[model samples]
Target: MKSSPLALGLLALGLLAPSVRAGLTAGMQEGKVELKSISQLAFGPEGVLFIADPKAAAILAVATGDTAPASGSATLRAEAINEKIAALVGTKSDDVIIEDLAVNPISRRAYLAVSRGRGPDAVPLLVRVDVQGQPELVALDRVRFARAELPDAPADVAPAAGRKGGSPRTESITDLAYADGRVLVAGLSNEEFSSTLRAIPFPFSRVERGTVVENYHGAHGRFETRAPVRTFVPYRIGGEQHLLAAYTCTPLVQFALSELKPGARITGKTIAEFGNRNRPLDIIVYQKDGRDYLLMANSSRGVIKVAAEQITPAAKSITAKVSDTDGLKFEKIDWAGVAQLDRLDARHALVVRTGAGRALNLETMALP
Candidate 1:
């Protein structure tokens, strides 16, 4: 995600808010490869960390188990999990760009959000690729990923407009997640700030054709404009299923799964807010030592950590700003994607730094 000077100015103003206790500081260890551009990341079972390198046309994997290096040294090294994933779909890398990454907790399979072109002709798609098997890539549009049982649209919303590619059809999917045999996709628009969210109830490996579950416009609240929703993660709050969504143009938005159902009317009461003016590039939820944390990667702020408890709708803000005299502040890092992993007794994470060079640099941080 690229940040403009105007956006940075807004973030500086946001820092003026009341200060709170700064989160724990974690040791940072850089990765091996220089990632030109990364989309998203996820940590699989055991100690495997998966990174989506769209520009490189491959997925990078790192093992952060006992084999990791000692302290002060880079613990993660980028290895190509599989190359030419787009080729598997009979398309060349130039014709398709990988945009998002998701890992299924139950199936242990990784999914990629692929976009097909550079212009309006570009068709956005969701594909599931095997990380452990022969590494086959299958498009979700080919098969139903899940059962669709959404409410009927209001009579005011014309039927033709309610169909996909209607008045406000999404052109890109920025984030994806699979859980309980259902896939949640976050739609982003390059021409507009608002985005859409859809839930597909089927396995990625079997999706035959593209399906629409729900479309969220910005009419619900002040934070609900046509902002570019960059990431989405499924989080369990107080034992209830909810969705944590972040945008690059606005603050974060949270809502229950029930409220996100297709054709379901949602309002400010159904949404929770987080983050500041800084554009959030990616987000991940990790549990360490029985404690849960929300890790966010901001374009201007390297990585910000917040306790899960502070994510309530009542919280005044999402993160607390810290002072630095050595200029060792978050601005020094150009973060693209982030992931959290558990390696033995240590909690590890990998962050992809973009625009620095050709190879993807993975930074390992020790979780407190």
Candidate 2:
């Protein structure tokens, strides 16, 4: 194989380091991070960790400095993860709440967003799981980090429409993901169209208002705009980047990345209605036998494996009422009580699920 002239020029300009070339950390500053809360976590290039602080209406990008390429097999299993985290934090197992889990693609290490307590004063902490499945706190004492504050976060005092005593502000950021040098944030905003999806460029520039999004819910027999996306994953459809977002009452919608412009209102294509009265907790995209699939964890529904081949460019939208699951057929996996998940390797997934005695457990399972 021979290097092309463009490759040689790029090498000379040091553009091979995708992160540096894209200014992933160009404007970041080194300091201690004061996180008010940890609602979600995602990993970008060069071990940069994106933490969502919904309470603070901000997103922090921390350079985790865990970029050493993983060696050998990265399979992991840790039973009773809640107890382990409680023991590590000197709290009761029942008080430990794991909010989210993300695996560093480069290091293959798992990082968790945890709440040490279950009350309003609960302390937020980030924990790292070693190759041996041991939980360790990630110190925020002095690290390179950048913060992006949402300019139009909902009012913290406003009570949610249906949930009594629940503040809409707390749902300002429900999910976070890194894709193609941008951080995609899904949650509610103060704008008239509360439900929003934001795409923020890396290196922390001026945070802009999010793109308002709406979707037709087949199970509900109506369109909804105020409900935030519970979970979503970036996927390619017909060779173009798009987001596959799952919302409460289980509607799977698709939005093109190019259409998520600032302050724009867009209607997503509803491709599937998984069911009703269920919340999508997490989602991961993987490939098997040269075909892509979506592994989703739900609150009431068990894990499901959805074939990505059905999301073709000409796929019809599910607009009518649904009795059960409709559009883009799925196979329910035997996995039960799954709360959070991430891809650990090419052939395995790291999942946190309830085990005996309702205790949470972390384990890696083969991609079905």
- Clashes in model 2: which pairs? none
- The local distance difference test score of each candidate is 0.45, 0.82
Off by over 4 Å in 2: 1-23, 154-170, 189-193, 206-225
In angstroms, give how far residue 139 of model 2 lies from its true place: 1.0
Which candidate has the top score in lDDT?
2
**Tens-digit per-residue lDDT, 189-223, candidate 1:** 44444455655543222232223333343433333
Q: Which 10-residue span in candidate 1 carries the lowest summed lDDT?
A: 19-28
Model 1, residue 224: displacement in angstroms? 5.7
What tens digits encode model 2's per-residue C-alpha lDDT throughout 1-368?
Answer: 12578866887888775544444666678999999988899998888999999888888999998888888777888899889999999999999999999999888999999999988899999999876778999999999999988655444454466677654344557789988767888885544445677788776766443344443333344754555677889998999999999876468888788887755666778898877767898999999999999999888778888999999888878877767778889988988889999999889999999999958999999999
TM-score against truth, every candidate: 0.50, 0.87
Each prediction's Cα RMSD?
16.3, 4.6
Q: Candidate 2's error at 146, in angstroms?
A: 0.8
Candidate 2 C-alpha error for residue 347, in Å: 0.6
Cα shift from native, residue 152, model 2 (Å): 2.5
